[model samples]
Target: MLRGTAAVSVQRLAPEDLGPAAADCVFEALAARPKPVIGVATGSSPSPLYQALAASPRDFGSATWFALDEYVGLPQGHPESYAEVLRREIIEPLGLDPRTVHLPNPHTGDHQAACARYEQQIAEAGGIDLQILGIGRNGHLAFNEPGGALDSCTRLETLTEDTRSANQRFFDSPEDVPTHCLTQGLGTILAARHLLLIAQGAGKAEALRAALKGPVSRDCPASVLQLHSRVTVLADAEAASLL
Candidate 1:
C-alpha cells in the first residue's frame, strides 16, 4: 500500500499480467458478498479484465453491474454508446442477467432527473463494492473532466475536445462523437468501498504520474484518487513509466 500523501496501492506489471491481477480483485469482492454491486468501466483499458472475468468458470450471475458513464445523444442500440459497449464486452459474455445491469439513461428529456434517479438507484443498492476505473488522457475519471468540482455528484457534463478526439475512433467520424455525457462524479465514485484503476500504453504515462504523484486538484481530476483510502492502481510498464 502506498503511504505519505497518497493512500493508494500501486502495482506496476507487464501488459499481459494485468488481467489476472485485476480479476483477483473482482473474485475477492465476489467472495465477500453474495450479490456484490460491481461498478464497471468502458474503455480499452478494461477490456482484458472483462475478458478474464468472462473466461473464468466461477459464477457471476449474482452480481449487479453499474456502468460509469454514457454518451447523452446516442440512441439505445447505437454501437458506440456505453450501454451497448458494456452489453457486448461484459454482460452477454459473462451471461449476467440484463435486469441486473444499470446505466445512466441518455435518452431522457430531463437529464438532471435521470442523473438524480441513477444516484438513488445506487444508494438503494447499498453503494458499490468495487469500482473498476480508467483514467482519461487528460486525467478525467468517468466523464468528470478537469476543472470539475471535487464534490460534484451524478450529473451531466461537457466533454473536453481532447476527450472527444480520443473517443473518435469508436465513431464513424470525429463529428459523431457526442459532446455531452452523463457520469458518476468524483464524489460518487469515492463512495465505493474499493476502487481498481487500470491503465496501459505510453499515452497514459503522464496522466498516471500526475494522478499518483501530484497534488490533489481540479486541474487533474484523477489526482483525486489520492484522497480515497482503498485505491488499487494496476498500470502496465508504459503507463507507469513516468512514475
Candidate 2:
C-alpha cells in the first residue's frame, strides 16, 4: 500500500506459510549486516517465525536481540514474562548466547531512567537492523496503547482493560496479568531500518485493516506504520479479510 512517500508492502498467505516467509525477511536482514541487531516481539503471532529460525541452519550466534516490551511486576523468571518467554522460544531454540539478548527492565526502581538506558543501549548497538512486530487486537504496536504520542520514546505504560483481557489466556486469571509494561515507544520502533509485522486469525482482521489502510493517527497506534519508509505486513487469509 502506497500512501504518498511511505510504502507498506502487504502480503497475504496461509497460516502455515507465514513462518518461512518471515524467516526470509530475517535472513535478508542478517545478510545485510555482519552483526545484525534485531528487535524481536514476544507474542503468539511471532512464535512460528521463531520456530522456523530455530529449525534453520543459519548461525544466529552473532546477532544481537532486543525485546520490544516486558510486563511490569512479573517475577524475573516468571514463565509468562517476555524475557523468559524469549529465552525459551528464541534463545534456547536458536542457541543464542544469553549475553547478546536484551530486554527492558521492568524491575527498576526508576522506570524513566531504565527507559533512557534502554534507548542508549540501542543507539550504542547501532540501532536495530530489523524489527519484528505483531499487532494487538486493539491496533497497539508493542505495549504502546491508544492515545500515546506518535513521537513517544521508550517508557512505562499502563495496560488497558482490552489488552489485559486479550492476554488473560496466558495467565491464571485476568487479574494475574500485569497492569503496566515497559515498551519501546513508537519513535524507537520507527528508527529501525526495516519492519516486519505478522498477523493471523480472524480476531486480528479489523486491527490489521486499520493498521494498513486506516488514517495515520494515535487512536490506532499501528496506523503509524503508514509513515515509515520501509514496512512489510504479512497476514493470514482471515487476518487480511478486512484489508
Our model 2 lands, by Cα RMSD against the true structure, at: 1.6
* Model 2 lDDT per residue over 1-243, tens place: 323224788888988999999999999999998989999998999999999999899899878899999999988899999989999999899999998999989887899999999999999999999999999999999999999999888999999999999999999988799999999999999999999999999999999888888888999999889889899888898988887
lDDT of 1: 0.92
For candidate 2, the clash count comes to 0
Instruction: Return model 1's CA RMSD, one decimal.
Output: 1.3
How do the residues 141-171 of candidate 1 rate in per-residue lDDT, one tens digit apiece?
A: 9999999999888999999999999999888
What Cα-based lDDT does every candidate model obtain?
0.92, 0.92
Runs of candidate 1 exceeding 4 Å displacement? 1-6
